[model samples]
Target: MKVEQNADLPKTTHCNKSRRNLTEEEKEARRIRRVLANRESARQTIRRRQ
Candidate 1:
């Protein structure tokens, strides 16, 4: 079986056909959720650049 990049994210992220069905609000919400979920990773990445 093929696994996805992020275990925390939904499988829909890898399916463009399904993604196209999402409303704008849903897309925005999904982006927000992804950002929220990656807060610690984002902080670490920023810190590494310093």
Candidate 2:
């Protein structure tokens, strides 16, 4: 019999679905995090263009 390798496995997640069930505060925190991340990305783009 030959042996099988499962070294590379894909992850199955339901985190995004569960996140939708979070409270308002948690959703707001995520929004804030995304806003901050976007702001930093914009700053980097401006610096690169300069």
Candidate 3:
């Protein structure tokens, strides 16, 4: 009986880039949404403790 070993492999490189820009309004909206999400999570934690 005989066994063969395989331990050689090649790595690949990726080069991805973004191609879209956000306007000022869009940026503000994203910031507000994130703040609201965090606030909601904190409220949930306080409710659990009560």
Worst 10 contiguous positions by lDDT, candidate 1: 1-10
Q: For model 1, what is the error of residue 5's alpha carbon versus the real structure, in angstroms, after optimal superposition?
A: 12
Off by over 4 Å in 2: 1-20
Count of clashes, each model? 0, 0, 0
lDDT of 1 by residue, 1-50 (tens): 22233635666756766445768897787787666657767676898999
Candidate 1 local lDDT, residue 32: 71
On residues 1-50, what C-alpha lDDT tens digit does candidate 2 reach at each position? 22123212212354555444657896676666666666666777898999
TM-score for every candidate vs. truth?
0.42, 0.61, 0.56
lDDT of each: 0.65, 0.55, 0.52
Ranking by TM-score: 2, 3, 1
> Scored by Cα lDDT, where does model 1 land?
0.65
Which predicted model would earn the best lDDT? 1
Write down the worst ten-residue block by lDDT for model 3: 2-11
Choose the strongest candidate by TM-score. 2
Model 2: residue 45 alpha-carbon error in angstroms: 0.3
Of candidates 3 and 1, the better by lDDT: 1
